[model samples]
Target chain A: MAAVPELLLDPAIKIWVLLPISIVMVLVGILRNNVTTLFLSPKRTVPNVRLLKEQQHLGLLRTYRRNHHVFISQSDFDEKFDLFKKEYEFDNLMRHYVADPEKLQKLKENPNDFNTVMSDLSSGDMMMQMLKGNLANYIPQTVIMYWVNFFYKNYIVMKLPFNLTNNFKSMLQSSMNMIDLDASYVSAISWYFVNLMGLSSIYALVLNDNEMVTQITQQTTQQQQPAPPTAGGPTVDQLFNSELEGFKITDIKSCFTTIHDRVLEKYQ
Target chain B: MPIVNPSPRQPIVIIMSSNKKYLLNQYKTSQYLNLSPPNLLQLFNSCKVFLATTNKLSPLERQSILELYFYLSILTNHDIEAKSTLQKLKESLPLTSKSEKLAVLESYYLEAIGSTNTSSSTSQEKKDAKQVSSSKKQETILKELEEYLTQVQTLIVNDENKSRAMSLTSQQAGPLSRMTTNDLRTIVKRKVALHKSFSSIDTYVNQLIDFLQVNTMDPFTWNELGQTYHKLGELTKAHSCFMEIAVLQPLNYKNWLQLADLEVELFYSGDLVAFNVLNDSILHYLRAVELCEVLVDAWIGLVVALKLIPVSEMEKSGVNSKLKPLEDLKGKYDQLLKLAAKKVNKFVELGLVTDDKKLNSVKAVLDDTK
Candidate 1:
């Protein structure tokens, strides 16, 4: 193995190259958060009432499945279960808007009809907001990377205080083409990358509950778009069927049947 | 300094007993507290004082204070203050926002106005010494509310249309300026509150059920439906509604107490599964007491429910396979009776139960169980 080439650059590189990139990145991140907040309106779009009802109904069924043994009697539980079953079969959930009975039946049969489901649940407002969020996320990083590359392309900005193995050479020393430079020495581009990722703590100190900042910043780290989680997932009918399956598997055990025993165990 | 003020240094003992707990505390509204006229006035004044420094508080704090002020003003029959508070809240909170709290407040405001209008007309009738135009005035009052109802209906229609247009055009969905399900429920609640006549309550029950069908998990609507059932003497329906609340919020001592009271009623009425429900009532009371150890009423209730369990059932060895045999279960009952007696005695000693007759009755019941 060859020894690393001893390279002592000017100390002024720390003041000129490193500080400017770090400070500019932090300021740009803060600015992007505020700009996104201004660009995206605060009002939440109301979902369709029938879809809302269906979602809430499914939630109630899930609660029942979890808590059948708590307080409800077997007869009452069965009655409610039978009622919900009948409603599910008839697709009474979307009765208000869905006029065609055949289409409703078809929907119940093939719940993965993505086109129909998407049309029913999608909101243009959400798509637009997501677009704006992506723009806010990518535009700044691109501009910052270009600015750093154009101005301080080949400068070795600073040496890390701690040593890193040669495995980090590709990451920490990206633009500077010196093969024997130790991996602990960070270049201008890698410094920008480090500042981009590591300045979250500094951003946290500067920002408050301004959620727009987090939403935009999170998109860069977490590649998953904050498209409404339910959208492009399982259709509502599919969710209903799955919840029904959960409800059906659980047997009703009323607390009344064993209350005396429980009380005795506690008191005695 | 040498004398040291030595006069037999006494030991300082701190009693450190728990404070008497209520299922519904002082923070609840006057309606729940059943506050008298003078106390209601005092509460209204204090709430007004809190409202004066709204700028200093956070947004959530300001909203809560404003809601408290609105409820107090309406209950205290201060029409001017109530109207102004409602107007102020409407300005601050978007009318189409999906918050049920605002919808409930608006319904209450409408009810208050309805009552005041009727009362004023009645007073005018008394001054004129005539009852001839009473029906006419009633008609006018109905017209006023109906006019407002039409306005709300039109708003709902407009919201529906806007949503349809958005769905078609894929346009930038405007702000959450849409009529919520709670808004519709609020209209029905206002109708129920104003027309306290027998027939409208039946319709209100149907409307509330319709609302609950959609928003199944809303505790507020469930509570409202339960109260309506209770008013109409449908104990079974009311029991189920209160049961939902108890299950939804198991930690809430008040819901447990309500359910237990209903169970006791159903047991006495012979409408429930007899022995099983009595045991359930005892369990509920035990839960209530567990939550608030100083709850004397729950102790009394526990005694009542425990006594109602037939001796024959307790003696049966094979009633439930999960339960212990006769001797052990019977001993458990005896232990529970002793526990209730001890708790009631402690409450009396702590000056919690001031009424002598009620105390004696509770003690007598506990002693009988023993």
Candidate 2:
């Protein structure tokens, strides 16, 4: 480890190589947000009324009520519970509204439907979404990788401030041929990847949770399958069932058992 | 802040993710201090360091604090500060990532406030609110409503809606129809806040009722409708809306408070003709306090409701007002006053830069009440 030699890097490398790559990544990210926002913010198109009617009740009230039950009263809870049980108990809703038995038959035949804008409702749109999302996510990344390799080649851009183990000697160097380069030193292409990862954090800081990246990933995965768990748009009956199921876990009654003590204890 | 959105009309509500305990406390405090903007500001500002600290405050909290600052500023007539604050919020906030409705509403209200003349005609539109139309017109209204709702659904959390309704000829924005559920509700609440005539609120109310007919489970929508009715002096209808909210959102003590407040308002409005309702209102306040003991409003509301029970009614119940019932009342009042005092003291302890005069008044109420 002590035998490893340090390659003195030119100050210009920091200015020309490191700085430009980071700036490019940041600029590209911002551009990506604008581009995606443009693509994402289209007016909603309802291709199939039947399909929409099915998807309307996914988690809207069920989720809201589960989280906010403490905000309502016992009578209110009972009233809602009764409505939930009457409509959504067991598989009553599933049979009546959610899972369309005829959906398979329609799919098997030449289903003439081609209007659902969201991929969930239309097979054609889902396929297109799959194609578009995968292309966008991967194409630029590969293109940039090859371009960085072609231009920067094998130049070591920066040295790590710390010493590295002999095991890291291979993986740390982006260039295999540069045997003289210590594990602490990074090649131009490898530096770009490292910088890309680092700049990704900056994007996280700027956009909260990198919601754009998450949305695309989610969209791509859910594109192929019609029913993604989160926003699957199950029928009203399904929503009722799920909400009823969720109510089992929400002990809303616990909020009022100690009314007298709770009211009196505050002053004491 | 100036991001191109599809629907500039929809108001966004972004509740921040913080310590759940703190967020709940904040929400309750916000409700308690609704009429007192200065105290609300002081309460929010008291946690300025904690709310702003990177680790202490989540991204949502950071965004929420700024939102509160914007709202509290606008409400208190700090127009210049609100303008600059709005700019700052736009430049460096979660306006990009969070619920955008409050900011949008704040800006919209500020503009609405700036020029009451244009919105004054809103009253005229509201008066025309109840002219029901032909069945064919109703069909078109329903069709347009469906389209608008679909568009709203697609417009992600931060995305805006692009409405074709705005460009529609007068014939299209039907007599009984206008705006999405959320937009109608926000405008209604705004009208109530401005103390405007109720004529304009009717159209929005009609639209909201129509929406509720379809989307019965939305508690906030019901609550908004209830508040609109409450403000419009339609206690019976407002009580129904609040009752719906209670049924839909049983865990929310707010619904109970609203119902209680409504009942009390009704009893008072009708010259205290309903002693049963007064008793019912007291029960609701008791429920509210049970759910959230820290809520000073519920405590105050309980005491006030009790005090409002006329001596004749108490005596009619066969309880001597001076000896037994009034004595019980005095004990409750003392406890409530203490709780309110404790709340104010807690705020001061937290270093809230509050209205000294208001705090003194609260104390004066505490001291002066023998």
Candidate 3:
């Protein structure tokens, strides 16, 4: 039930210590972004149009298979479904992907192993770019951390306006071992960490850099999806196969049966 | 002589319509007037304002504004601005599938310039299009379009090979593909746009069929093919194409209306079994009316369909009035006819920007029948 004591910090700390640390952190982060852009390859790989074509066709087939039953006659729906099923059969679609001898062997060994077949795919260039990005992120962070620690060690650089619980004490007060300091008094090194994490709004204001955003999204997407057949995602055959599975499960319910009553009710 | 007083309304009207946002909104609302001279000139003026404030806009906005400016200048026959805007689009857009779009735009620019040469027009006859026969000009444009099509094909083929090679070496797919879906759609559409004669339309129809073979699900191309077939009076083929679109976009009232109109046409042609065709037309009209009750065309079509259906068919088990007697059905049809007439008059009175004169004619038809 004891009231938390407020520290009367020196006024000069605001001018010399806190501002310099925050400003330097912001400048360093921006510099890192620019340096990363300069060092990285500007050549964004063009998406394979053939793969795009295949994907679009698959999408069309999917929508058709899913929606056709609602409006089309049963005979018409069945006719189209059979045609799509035949065209997208494993044997027919394999021609697009099985031009490779290894894929042919893999298909021969196991007809349904689409996942395992694509698991081995990787791009050396993509790997190198990821490594470069990690290095760019880490080196500047380490340099800033060292600079702040060596110069402004044991110094409380900021008193945060909002109260944080003692749970954040370990994180917000990393360098100092003061037992009685309030959790709001942020250390110089922790201030650098805060600016590094928190300056995205500042970046949005200062830099209209779509390239940076796309690069991050590309990295994340690369991590999320399976490596593509040509670049960094799934193969065309794999996509077609999944869509065929979708086709197999689709149920048809024609609209003709109820049209008579619907018309009469609307008129009535 | 009476001195004319300058009207206060004159400048206000100009200022109101000439406002950039107002013009853009007007253009968006009434897109059919896009090629009209006054609208084009006003849009071009507003587009110039956007072009001046280009630096403050985002890259995507700037690119779209430039594209709009390019099309407007081409339509307005401002050849220099058109070329410069296209050049800016080429430079600003990344070299990807967008390149195919740029190629299409370049072909559009070529068509506008009316250059016979594969390269830019170096001829002295650039402005003398009126002197030549219109057919000859179209022939030259088609030839130029074909040349550009071949050039794009080669580019796509080469790009495809490169990506194929890259994919083989690396397990990942390459960024470059030959021709994208958008590329194919635009190219086929360009071909479709060029033809006017019967023989050429047949050829274009064949080309569209081939394109559809590769892309089995494109509704736009299917609709284009259907419209072309309808023009050719090949009613069955047009029916099938419109059927495909109806299946694809079931909720679109316009598609239902189109199908209903085609069915009515087929019924009038007296080729197919009349009973089922009338039934289908009635269903389609009902569907269109269900989607959009205010659709004047659907209401008129419904009235026509009801009049066409035989009394025996109306009393039949599968028709709408299965339980009701023929007299009741007849009475209902009369009421429906009156309702259609009332709706048509109401819509005509509302004077919405739709074809009010057409609605009046439709109303007259409904009144005559009633």
Candidate 4:
């Protein structure tokens, strides 16, 4: 077992360094949120008619599959299922989209040009979206790091009033000129990170419940397809087919047991 | 120890702090509370003062303000300033705002306008032989609401149109991406609730049932869907809806009372599929009272259900175990009646229950002095 060292930090460090970094992070987050909202203007506000149609159909299918038994007779459910299967089975919109000669020609001529392909079925401006998300998350962090490194280098921001481990000492003393920096001490470079992580709740109150840290931390988890290389975006037909398969596998009867038994149970 | 001189609303501050626990109770008994108009006015003023003092009221708080104003105006008929409030809601609300209560209130205000206009037309028809044609005004308002609801339906219920609607709503002030499904479902429920015709309600039910298929956890929607059936005169489906609600929220006395009421309705209609429905109604009413003793509505429902239950069925259903509750109810019947009379007098003093039929109904039930 390794023994942990301790050092006490000055209360003055909280007011001077910690507060400034956190305030900066919170401000940066709000700025990024507003900027992101502004940048997506024309596309965000204008309805893409094709995408809307597909989504509405998907909603209809999902709603019907899950709850039709409650409202409709068994005969009606079966009839609707038959109609849905017939309409959506062979002429899958997504599959049809993949084979269009005009779309294929555009993709072939300029393989790297996402904007042209993304206009209709190819990913809904995914590259632009990814760029915006990454910029929002990483730009402030990298800029802040460089700014802090260049300005506050070789300066110890504060000393931790408690002792800590050698590993932590190395991390806290990254920019400090001292050879054996105290574990309890925080360099100005490292101080920025501690404050950045703690200012989420403060900004959430100010920015209409928008969290600054989430913009940075959860960027990698954004919707990106690692599926077939060419098909970059999720299409309505693909989702519909998958949802239909899910509906087929699970018996609705199992989810919905007769309510008569439920009602009778209380009586007994 | 005195940090600052307390405001005159000191008693209200204490009540506000104490009443947090009783909010659910208050929601259930808002009808009975509506009788005492002065108490309501006090509550409204206190809420208004608190809201004024608070920095940036949250959406939940705003929703409460809407509800309080709704009870004050709609229930108490003190809607003298309602038009200004309705205008305020319109001006402030983001065009694509997704609050369900907001959706309901929008329709309610419109409906109130329609009915009020109709009543005004007839009253003025006698005075004006040669002017003031306002009969078309009600039709126009109703038509506008119907058109708005259809647009919402296309935007939400139709999956193909949802993305388009999303893009359109993005331009609006407060329509967050998270509120898509919830907002749509709420719009559907509110629209159905406001539908004057049963056929319109039936059509809306198909969509509501489909939405509920996937999101069955929402109990309020389930109750709303059941009430739609109750309106459409489908007692079996109504019972099913309440039954589903009871299963989802076992401790909720409201669902049981609704179910008991449905059974009583069925007993009256002579549409008993099972001979045990009469006993079942009594059982459900008992269960409701047991779940919430403070539910004064449930007591009335119990009295109705019990009065209908045949004497022979009680014996067959093991009357011994249920005897104690019946005895307790009978013992307190006279006292409960007195409390009810006092409440009725308070309501009368407020001039709310002015209609003869309404007064006669209450007098028939609680007027045990004779």
Candidate 5:
């Protein structure tokens, strides 16, 4: 009878103490998992400078493909290409380039051509800047960062021990929560990656088409020459007033009569 | 006769030729020519008298002159008298010499008469009068033939043979009554094709069917009638005709195909419900498929109809519970694919790569499902 009160009190104290402790442990485990996801995730940091370099290389190749004849006049094209390359490099370093003396010289020499070239260069530069400004804007960056943080924080940091029985049960419950979290993240990341790839491919296609049109225009201008007036009053008037005109009239009438005669002879 | 005017009648003189030149010149100068219809008729009669006396004219020249006379009669609304005079001129000319010209003139005459009849429906009396006048001309031709026969009788070396020939000629000359319904139907079809006028076609088709009765059971004729009925939106009649074809030629794929097409068309036009009408087509196609399972078109139709009924609704209808039938169908499709593969294997064994790409694609889909 005396031992019954002790037993009751002992169980009550354990419930009061362990319940709060267990709640704290579970909450801390969740917080640790989230923190790891945030900080220690393997993130892809896009090198803006590297992207700019690659874009510049592609732009040069496109320009060459478009105006292959321009490459035949190597000195002129190379000088222009060098100027464009310098402008791009400056833009990369400065985040944006103001109209510099070299750029002004290029513009003055071929104002229309230079304007289009500069516009394309600036657009590519701006895109790179935006990518660098937010890692999440690029899918691979976000995915890598998410997984790295998740692995580091939850598995590595949250190594706390509890009584084996309780700890096993808590781990099981947390793992269920983890499955849902992992599914959602995977779905989002996959969607983002697919969309980003599609958009980038479309951008590439447009750029390719632009380069093709520019090259065609340049080649046509090179091949074409103005015609000089002939010795006659004009070729048009000569053609209209020549003996051929009289011959044509007779020819037309003859043609009609021949057809008429053939049809009549056949039917008759 | 006095000359009335010169310039207005110049065209008529040129058309009639130089032999009638004096008569036309007199008519142009005539004082009574423009006075009234009777006075105009008198002047024209004087011209005709002069034309009849002109003997030096060639046969072509005579035709040209007589054509002018008929033209004047038509312009003056004296069509009955014009037609009689033209018929007389036609008979007097050697048949071969004027046949082509006469055919042209007859077509013009018929067109003119048709236009005149259409223009004024006010006077039934005028129409009746024209009919009576035509009948009189026919009677006059018959009387001339009788006189000619009597004249021939006087010269006959064999009287019985002459009488027999006269009887045969008379029988040929009498009205042949009506054409066979088949001929009428052919004429109707030609007219429908040429004029594309349903107004005449409907009447002609009905006349042919009524006249021909059971003789009109020819599938081609029924098919044509069904098409015409369908065009007119007389679905019941069209259906009956099509059904008759189906009954008459149960094995004819074309008849079944047309019926299926009509059912779909009727369903689309709101003449039939989507469900009921489409099911009828589906059933027909199923029958067609049963007859020829290699019928890709029928299979396509079945696939389309089945696709239209939502899978969720099918499930709700206990279709899923009873999917043994569907499973059996799926198994059949699979078996068919296997058979197709075997057939392709035979072709492949002979080194035919033309169908290899398609077979490979089908094989891919099969493999993916498996």
Candidate 6:
């Protein structure tokens, strides 16, 4: 009776306690392995993602170089990266579908079926790969490490996160009613900051309006000064007056007489 | 310091000094500080006093003082004062023998009058009255004569001085004397006519003819006589003057052109005898064209004269002889038309002739000629 009682001790309770404890232990072990794999494992590193992104940016620049007319600097490159990312994603997706024309034709016929198939295939492939590497034992640690790298690449020095947060808040407000779950808020935030800061900084560095105004004012003032006197020549005022007097009206009939009189008076 | 009695010269000097100080104060206030009407008038009065007291000064000094007075008067809006100051300055200055001074004076007077007319309240009626006054007209005539005479005197003096100074005295004097004499005669004649003293026009014309006889080979002198005769309304004499010029210098296109114009005027006025004159004018133009075939005016005149020729006479004149003049004229016209066509082509190439109507009109004209 005592043995029976021990065996039958609230089956539900036993199941809850023992099952949870075992799951936790397994989880702990998996986390430990994941940590090692993410941080120290040699095989997890991908060689081509950075190179791919760099090549994508260069391709975009080449496309615009002949026809853009505007000069693009390093800052402009940062601004255009998001657009490149979208184009790259679409191109990659197209290439993936092009590799399997049967799947693409199925997709063209029924998009839902194609999506379901792809989702299932990708999930199955991920699980298989994870199992092959025994990364199921390291999933938690892998996630943590992935996050750490993301932070280091995108949010170190706090600027990236701050801008990202603001952009998220703006998008949340602007697209509050939109039901798109796949839209990337982080990418939007990055593009917003790049454009705003890049344009303002360039304008500040290139155009010095205050200095130009001062130069113009000084030049205008210099030109306004009166001309100087010359040697042996009558003063400007004297010459002006003498010219005036030479043409003045005197007695109508005796004008030359008056001129003669005036000339003689000065000589005398 | 006040206990000692001063001499009369001391009081006079003291008065003058005090007056100068007052004037200086007024000038400073008017020019720099305030510039009110009363202050300007005070400056003008002070300048006037300065001029009156400074009688023994040189013409240059007097000129400077008068200039100051004129400026002050203008600032004060005192036209009468400005005029008087200008008159005194002119009187005080020595006259140059050259016409340059007179010309400068005339221009200055005109500018001053224009400024006053614009700024002053003088009515249009008053200005018209002044312009129409016979005395004013005579005054203008006299001033012009004086200016012309001054030019003649300066030219003569300059020539004489040059002759005295140069080793090539005879050579220099001959052309210079001849030119100077011609200029003097023209100037005198113009001066007399400008004064409207037509009583001596015939005498002047006779004098011009005599002077032109000396240089019968000089086309310019003949042209001058022709112009003078034309001005005097002696068309026959003018035509003869140009004809003589055309005969002497057959290459002068203007002589032929003028002769043609005079003959055309006469022919248009119903003088059938003008046909011979027209023929003579065309012959001269043709001769001119022979000298310089590129003369465009000769070609144009020849075309115009051909239109005037009686059609009955066309056959009487030899076929080649009649066609030669027309062919030469047409050739020149074609050359001009080619230049015009080139310009029009450039415009067409530039897409400047956007209006279809204008483009069509130009094309039609070009096609008709073709």
Listed models, DockQ each: 0.12, 0.06, 0.12, 0.04, 0.00, 0.00
Q: How should the candidates be ordered by TM-score, best one leading? A: 1, 3, 4, 2, 6, 5
* Candidate 1 per-residue lDDT over residues B1-370, each given as its tens digit: 0011211111122222112111113334323234544555666776676566435666655565666667767777777887788777777776564343455565566555653254455666666635547656555555566566656655665665454333322223323223454435445555554444323678668877877876778876788889899888898999889878766666776677778878898888889777667766777887777676666678778877777877576456345323335456666666787777777777768767756688778777756755
Q: Which runs of model 1 end up more than 4 angstroms from their true locations?
A: A1-47, A72-83, A94-97, A105-231, A251-268, B1-36, B49-55, B87-107, B115-143, B149-199, B313-328, B348-367
What tens digits encode model 2's per-residue C-alpha lDDT throughout A1-268? Answer: 4665556789998887777766776666666555556655333332222233234343444643554434334555556567656654434433432256565344324322211212233344334444555565556567666767887787777888998865676655766575555678777777766755556567666667666656433432333323322233543444456666776456564343344345667556
- What TM-score number comes out for model 5? 0.23
Best candidate according to TM-score: 1
Model 1 / residue B182 / CA error / Å: 6.9
Residue A108 alpha-carbon offset, candidate 3, angstroms: 8.9
Model 3 Cα lDDT, one tens digit per residue, A1-268: 5876788889999898889887886677667655545443323244444454576687787777767645535555666667777887666766655577777777867765654444333344445434554565667667878888888998988799998888898889988898777898899878877776666666566666766644433332234333454443555666776776776666677664565456556755
Greater lDDT among 4 and 5 belongs to 4
Question: Model 4 over residues B89-132: C-alpha lDDT tens digits?
Answer: 66566765433445556566656545434434665664662353
- Listed per prediction, chain B TM-scores read 0.72, 0.45, 0.75, 0.52, 0.34, 0.40
Q: Interface RMSD, all models, one decimal each?
A: 7.0, 12.6, 7.2, 13.0, 48.9, 47.9
| Model 2, span B1-370: residue lDDT tens | 1112222112223243434456446544554233343444454444443445546556665656665555555555556656665666566644444323443445343442443233454766645534534444344433433343334333432242223222211111121122233433333333333322223477667766655543556676688788788778889888878766665566587678778888898887884346556656766787776676555555556656765666465556755421124455546545654554555456445534144564565455545443
TM-scores, all candidates, are 0.63, 0.42, 0.61, 0.45, 0.23, 0.27
Q: Write the per-residue lDDT of candidate 6 for residues A169-243, one digit (tens) a residue.
A: 444223223333222322322332333223323333433444433322222222222211111243222332332
Q: Kindly report, for each predicted structure in the order presented, the TM-score of its chain A compared with the true chain A.
A: 0.67, 0.54, 0.63, 0.55, 0.17, 0.22
Q: Write the per-residue lDDT of candidate 4 for residues A59-170, one digit (tens) a residue.
A: 6566656554332134435555666677676344433344676665664455444333444332443343445455556777788888777766755677766778777966
For all candidates in order, the CA lDDT equals 0.65, 0.52, 0.65, 0.53, 0.41, 0.43
What's the CA error at residue B26 for candidate 6, in Å?
51
Where in model 3 is the C-alpha error above 4 Å? A1-49, A65-76, A86-268, B1-56, B87-98, B116-140, B149-199, B313-335, B348-364
lDDT of 5 by residue, A1-268 (tens): 2321211123443344334333333333234333323432122121232233333334433433343331112343345445435533423422322257676555445534433443454444334333332332224335443643343223211112332333343332332334322221222223222332333233334444554334323222233211111211322212223322232222111111122223223322
Instruction: Kindly report the interface RMSD of candidate 3, rounded to 1 decimal.
Output: 7.2
Q: Report the lDDT tens digits of candidate 6 across residue range B103-160.
A: 3333334333432233453698567756676666546545645564556645654654
Ranking of models by lDDT: 3, 1, 4, 2, 6, 5
